[model samples]
Target: MKLAVVGGGSTYTPELIDGFARLRDELPLSEIALVDPDERRLGLLAGMATRMLARAGHPARVTTATRAEEGVEGAGAVLLQLRVGGQAARDVDETLPLECGCVGQETTGAGGLAKALRTVPLVLDIAETVRRLAPDAWIVDFTNPVGIVTKALLDAGHRAIGLCNVAIGFQRRFAAALGVAPERVSLGHVGLNHLTWERAVYLDGEDVLPGVLADHAEEIAADLSMPGWLLRRLGSVPSYYLRYFYLHDAVVEEQRTKPSRAAEVAAMESALLEMYGDPSVDTKPELLEKRGGAFYSEAAVALVASLVGDRGDVQVVNARNGGTLPFLDDDAVIEVPARVDARGATPLPVDPVEPLYRGLIAHVSAYESLALDAAIQGGEERVRDALLAHPLIGQAGPADELARRLVDANRSFLPWAVSR
Candidate 1:
């Protein structure tokens, strides 16, 4: 009946609150505790959430906490959406890897590994507190690098499931293109977090991907930044993040000339916080859509509803492999459709992955394993090894250089690097 949001001060909070308000019948809550370290932001969000709930005639009480232990206590579910170093650090994560001629994005390549090192430890620490304070609560992680973060929680024996909006975003898009209700479109989403593909689009259990692609290949390809012919050739739709790997050189060049995604988000957050301070603003603003995380709240609400109510429904989530993909280690966290319920997420059986996607998934899975090592047991060598293992930075020369830059840029967040 009680739910807690670990990074409730984030500008993303209102979008979540809007979902809670609209979907009350699915997941009824008696209270919501917004947990954050920044009191000013937390206060602003709390007021906004209160107004939204009141306007919706939803009875859930909104509360604020400056500590994880305080907010998560006695809650049925805790959602982790924190940024360990905030946007300033994200700016570094986005731009620092360009020096090595690598894709300088937040959730992949050298930048993703850097974020893992800074984030995993703090998330695990919060999970421990959740263990002590709310032993039965489920921790739903919506953090970047969901695969790595969820794996750390699971490996440490926490009850957690990783959630992302990518699948829902695709489902919604496909449904719109087909002029059908969103629920009627089921995606055969496969691979690891951020690295995934939609192999099939099922309408009423029929594979209609070919038809959808035939009609809107160019439009879909445009959204993913890939060529329309490529979609027809591959017989599947790769997630947008795949562009980083598929068009690495071009992306690197563009990243060199363009402002980082972090900078854009930082500016958006500033405006959103100011908007939240207004008492008259009771609803989520249109500007929030451009802030990204499209359909995030819906995905979160559905997952939480299924878990809390034990619906035993299949939904896409970042869950343990458990032999669903024979090529991957059972403990590897993968983004795929899974049956979610009281026991947590169990990935569904996947059809044979094409060698192209399978090899990359296995490769990234290995890098993620090493990235976790570097995250849990911090050291420059672990960091370098993880970078070397990444498909994007396979060469030792760039890996070594990126690892050094990563640590130097994130020393304040990575305690082990402070001595250097």
Candidate 2:
């Protein structure tokens, strides 16, 4: 099978490539095409991948390309991992929301909306190319604002699924906290990325949250350390999103404060600046290389395993809800568990989420709609409505003010902004 990874020069690309390489035997993958615009970065990655594969004794054909059409042609699966704008632009995406005294973050609030505006067009273009190049390829998107972008692709009449590691990552963390094997822990989780809830967790068919919380208080507290500590202090396991989760009064009241969107964006910016400024002196890539041995390898192997393993089940994927979520529109993008087999992904039926989950979904939907409208219809009012509908905005007047400021500040990227 031929698998193409779009945006192959990205920082995360190596990890993903390592993932596919580890899965060669299980999935019987025959070729890999790395696609990116920057030839230098692409070559750097391709060389690194070639060396790694040689070391591992795998000999799959590893090719590189600059054009989406060239890389996507005849691909069975296309992993979308492009960053619409590099870290510099993402720094703006994260800091802008905080400047307005609201949550500035990559996947929520004005920052997320801005990201979607920039990313939607690029992703749509790629989707169009895929249609012309590899009509049957399954698009597995690993982009930010996963829900919103996934919705946009479906709206543009493409088959795509948004993939975020947060769900599985959180599940593993919770399993560790509970002193149980990850596979032994069963959970019911639902909501948007970075803001999901653990509705339930069980070990041996018994509710174990209370016991785990009590027994592992110290360990849990230690694990919840970094980026945003305030939310971790409030309660709940510190998922990467401890910042934004804590800011919401509803979630705070439930003692489930995760990070705020602003905090996450800040951390991401700092990390990117560090990456760009001192590409020579950083141990991050090395650390990531070591870490890649597990996550990327295991995940990619799992993908291949699902394809040819003894148990044939479709992998849970992120795709358009299409009545899968009763409360939301049929076209809404959702990340539900999916079963993946040789044929493709089949999403599982999930029950209606909680009111808070629904509320977040609504806000995300409004933001997604505005992004799509701006990208496809060139409308500004829709964008305004999206900002107003956000939970952080609180009131219409404040939302309007925030919208106007965002439009003014990001005029270069958002050319359809209304005149101040």
Candidate 3:
């Protein structure tokens, strides 16, 4: 099977290669086409992957391409991990909104909306190319704003599934806490993309979340950037991204005092690239762990295996709602546990969510719907609608200002912004 990674030059690619090496038997990889526009990083990654695969004694061939259309020609599956403007663009996405006293982070608030606008159109274009060349290929999107990007692909009639490592991260964390293998910890993970909660953790078919929370509350709470008492009160684990939503003002203030995550990642990428340039370096470096997106390799490998191999196993992922949550539209793309197979992802039944969670899910679903509109059609009014609908920028004054700043800062990437 041919698997193509669109942003195969990303520093995260080595971590993915490590997973493919360790779990080489899960997926039959005849060829891996690393596709990226950046020639230097692409060549370095191709050699790095060759070294890693050789170390693993895997027979799969490693190939590199400078064009998406060329690399994805005969792929059975394609993974989207592209960053539209690289860390420089992310620097804007992470710092721009802070000027307006709003949460300034990628994948949320005006910043995430900006990323959606820049990314969705480009991914759609690539999807079009895949359809033309590899019509049966399954698209596994690990792009930021996974929910929105996946929705765009599905809306365009492409077969796709959105994957996030948050669920896998939590599962691994919980399993370590329980002294069990990662696969033994099953999460009742629910919500959209980064906006998710672990309501339960099953160990040997029994819910042990309460016990985990009781014994390891402070450790888990610190990871989520919330108080342990709050975790005790809520009886669930909220993903760290929720901190931006739950404590918007506090987060903004904290963000103002520090360098943007993009800047930090930029420095990290520079060093990581230097390491990848070393032909003697075969394994993923220790520094890559600090680069974040932990457990991505395992998550990506397992999801691709399920899709290409038609394993029909259950995994937490982003897919169509399909009435799983009564409040959301059937076409709404949601992050939840699903039974994944060759056909597509079908959301598993969720326990009735509280109105508190449901209301926010519904609210964000509305924002995403509008966001996708602005992303696809592209207009000033459409951008305003999306910003206003967003819970982080619901008021007119802040929404309008952020929308203008977003477009202005991203004009290079947003064709509509340039044209207008």
Candidate 4:
């Protein structure tokens, strides 16, 4: 089978290519089309991918294409991993929100809305191309603001599944702490992308979450930057991104004192690219671990394998709500454990959520709906309204200011804003 990676130039591609090689048995790929607009970066990554695959004795042909149309053609799966305005734009997204006294994040607050506005339209356009070139292909989105992007694709009637590494990362971590193989761990992970919680951890069909917390609360809390008491009190582990909500003011203070994550990632990308160009580097570098997206390759490969091979196995993925959560609309995209097969991902049944978690999830889900509307039908008011709805930017004053700054800073990316 053939697979196409839309943002093949990204530093994350090598890690993905490594997974394609290591897990060749799980998902046998005959060809990989690396699609990117930057020919220089594309060439560097293609060479790296070819070498890595060859070293693994996998006979997959690596091809390069500058156009999404050309790259996705005849592929069984199209992986969308592109960044619309690149890290330069992400730097602005991360910093611009701090001006409004909000958390400066790329995927959850005012910054996340800015990214959604710029990304959703572009992703939809690509989905259109995928429809024309590879109609039956499953579009596995690993893009930021995945919940919003996946909603757009599903809204446009595309066969798509949103994939994130958060669930897989948690599974791997929990398995290590419990001294079990990664596959032996299953998470009762639920909520939106980047905004999820590990409600339960099952090993051999038994929930050992209480034992995990009892034994490893301090270490787990340290990783999430949350107090161990909070995990114990809630009887669940919140994703690290929840820190933005749980300790908003504290996080803002810390963000102000440090360089934006975009800056760090930018520098890391430079070093990673330099390493990618070296012929001797046939394997993924250790530095890639610090670059984040931990275990992304495993997650992506497994999801694609399940989808292509008609393996009706359960995996955590972002899929339509379909009444899985009684409060959310059927069309709302939710991140949860789902059964995957050739038909697509179907969210598994979830137990009733506590009011504490449900309230926050509902609030964010509402904001996401408005954000999607603003992304699809661009206007200053829609942007302002979406910002106002966000729990991080609930006040109208900052919301209005953020709306103006977001549009102005991202005018080049938002065509409607550009025309205005």
Q: TM-scores of all models?
A: 0.99, 0.80, 0.99, 0.99
Error of 2 at 62 (Å): 1.8
User: For each candidate, what is the lDDT?
Assistant: 0.94, 0.64, 0.92, 0.94
Order of quality (lDDT): 1, 4, 3, 2
lDDT of 3 by residue, 1-420 (tens): 899999999999988888888888898688999999999999999999999999999888999998997899989999999999999999998898999888988999899999999999999999999999999999999998999999999999998999999999999999999999987789999898888888999998899999999899999999889989988887999999888888888999999999999999999999999999999999999999999989999999999999888889999999999999988999999999999988888889999998768888899999999999999999878999999998888999988888888888889888877877
Q: Which stretches in model 1 have alpha-carbon errors above 4 Å?
A: none
User: Residue 185 in candidate 3 has what lDDT?
Assistant: 81
Question: Per-residue lDDT tens digits of candidate 1, residues 246-290?
Answer: 899999999899999999999999999999999999999999999
Model 4, range 43-91, lDDT digits (tens) per residue? 9999999999999999999999999988999999999999988899999
Q: Kindly list the per-residue Cα lDDT of model 2 for residues 331-352, writing each as its tens digit.
A: 6666666677655456678766
- Candidate 3: segments with Cα more than 4 A from true spot: none
Candidate 2, run of 10 with poorest lDDT: 226-235
Residue 375 alpha-carbon offset, candidate 2, angstroms: 3.7
